[model samples]
Target: MYRFLVPLACALSIAASATAAPRLVEPRLHIDKEHIGPARIALTFDACMGRVDMRILDVLLRERIPATIFVTARWLQHNRQAAATLLAHPDLFEIENHGAMHVPAVDYPTSIYGITAAGSPQAVAREVEGGAAAIVAAGAPQPRWFRGATARYTASSITEISRLGYKVAGYSINGDDGSLLGARAAEQRVAAARDGDVVIAHINQPSHAAGAGVAKGILALKKSGVHFVRLADTVAPHPTPVL
Candidate 1:
């Protein structure tokens, strides 16, 4: 009886492992230089649940730089004025879906960087669809791109997202490390962006100094003659796999 139980337990362990979500390396996307031309970079800001970082938005407006702003349903719900501000400048800002609740797009029970994931393929779909619905309801066009919270995903989640007909938005440069960097650090990171780089920063943490730095960095990039483009203006295929 003991031997039989051991084997059964082993089989169950194997089965569980087989069905467990496989965490893949976080995807990094970039502008295809051949397709996007030279001296151009894509700036993408994540408006995860938080107040609008007007420092960054103000710079974009003043400089007329084009950006892709990925927003969650929660952010939009609490930031109607900011959303309207973004929509007010359709020529400069293209809002995309971040997620329904800023949850990582992982189709399993897990967490990325301490944030809980969406947990299942079905939940992932609801997240994607819910965020899209919220965006449309907020008066923005249907979001064609989806950038999951934490920018991490499992293989199954990526496949699910693709099956849903939205291109996943990834980034080549992390400008603020999720708004954790100091002003100088964020400024230097973003100011260093080059042609065909897709930079990710946060526009939801106004209290953080990183937003101010990001603002400065954008001005620096503009001063150096770097052209900014929205994600809609260029085709960014699935970024090169990190793993």
Candidate 2:
């Protein structure tokens, strides 16, 4: 009986340690992604779900603008043609992980800005890994970066995700509020971007009026001489982890 209790105590100890969030060297941001070179801006699209924003993609492709795309498993399952289309333009885009179920990568099972987080550190890791595996199984290269649902993270969750070998992709600009925007608002949000800002917008809502705005903003940025780049070209993700 004593031996059984000892094992139980040890198990509880381990679980307790695992539940505690790690100390991060930095504070996490609502959108923490960085950008490219001096005159360059990184335009990142999040396909959270739904049909491809051909309105936005068309302009990017027509202009030969480079971009980074973050995709979820559900989005891939539902948008095969879109995935194939993106893969066809490898030079124009880098496909990265969004998560298996669009779960927020946070330390516990509470809502943040209406997002349901993964609840535990291990669950967060699974979300990151599952997203990567799904993307790889779909035939794209292994993703070097991940941005969880809502592009928000607790400092510890982001740190743990970084430890799993993917840089937690944060954005310098919220280009579209989850694709909820009017054309003018979307255009203003993105067009107002400064050099070196990693812009985060959506490619999941083609029917959304904001999609057209995203296109307009991209074109406006191009017209203003802002060069586009892939996240890879800017940051060599997977630096030595602080943890």
Candidate 3:
């Protein structure tokens, strides 16, 4: 009995040590390097709630610009018509998970504008799965990307996201339309985007001038020979882990 107890204690210690070690995350979510390409940029938007500024979306669709939209469950429910519209235009937009309730985590400390990170692994999965269900119900193909609330994601969350068979998305550039600095500044920000850059913006709260500016910038860039690509197409495929 004593021998067995001693071995059990040692095993527990080893297991705890292994768990304490830092987890591995995808390079794209944290790394800041670009590969060879034709200067492609993925324009993304986060639609949280209500009737969004369709004007911005209209521009993307009419211009045939490809984009990825990280949407929440609440947003889809509140704006089903708009959600359906986006779903119909598959060439212009790809729907991705942005969390369920967008609840911030208390156990871990992370922030974007002083907001906490999303909840635990299980909680995060629920958020992601829930949004995926909503998308499917609303007639959109399931999302392959997961962007955490506030865009503040941790290493653990990244591991969970990968385990759930979704890519962790982090932008290389921010157009800052959500920051609301007028359309001109927003256009300038988007114009500054380079090759292999993933530009982030918001279309949920469209009362600001910057969102409009972001749309304008994309068109202007197109006129100057900049081509837009869907984030799914731009991202490196996640390699399946060997068991």
Candidate 4:
């Protein structure tokens, strides 16, 4: 009886640890030839789920700034209304896939991370294809780009995803708003922003403390004449083509 009880306890411990693991796992970003030559930067927003911020969308459209927004299935389900509003403004944003579930395991390697959302090429296709469908249903053009969950992915995953007809979107710089740093620190982070830098920030998490600072930094840079362009415009054009 005691031996059996010990085994059960061990199983419970493993389960608990697994549940506590993070959802994003390899954390790689890609910057190709065009970005290197032109000093062009791509500003990207991730809309995972929960808490929507229209202010970010408002600023982009009002300023005529174009960005790539990576959306998740959860976000599409929860913010269909807001999604419609964003799609209507094609001039300001291009919606792409963040992944179907935004699960951390989907982006990590097998041995390092115990979980993987799209462990196989087939699974990756579903997340990418399903996400595209969701955006189309919400009125946005199908996404030709795919940014893996948590920005973590393997070479094989990248190859498979690309083979399946999606270009993996990566970043050159990060705004670190997810850290929830205040506007001051946020300003400091973006102060280093330059041409050809792909900067990532979260627009879905409205309550993020750093959101205000991120906005300020962009505004300040714009005043200095930094032209903002969508990632698709600046990235290496995919063979399948996305207009």
Best by TM-score: 1
- Report lDDT (CA) for all predictions: 0.91, 0.83, 0.71, 0.70
Give the residue spans of candidate 4 off by over 4 A.
Answer: 1-39, 105-116, 177-179, 235-243
Instruction: Provide the clash count, candidate 1.
Output: 0
Q: What TM-score do all the candidates reach, one by one?
A: 0.91, 0.82, 0.77, 0.76
lDDT of 3 by residue, 4-65 (tens): 99999999999999866333222342222355545667787887665587767889878888
Clashing pairs in 1: none
On residues 82-123, what C-alpha lDDT tens digit does candidate 4 reach at each position?
887777888787889887777532433343334456665577
Better of 3 and 4 by TM-score: 3
lDDT of 2 by residue, 44-155 (tens): 9999878898899889889999999999999999999999999999999899999999988877777867777798999999899999999999999999988888666677
Candidate 1, position 28, lDDT: 84
Of 1 and 2, the candidate ahead on TM-score is 1
lDDT, residue 19, candidate 1: 88
**Candidate 3 — which pairs collide?**
39-195, 105-117
lDDT value, residue 89 of candidate 3? 83
- Using TM-score as the measure, name the better of candidate 2 and candidate 3: 2
Name the TM-score of candidate 1.
Answer: 0.91
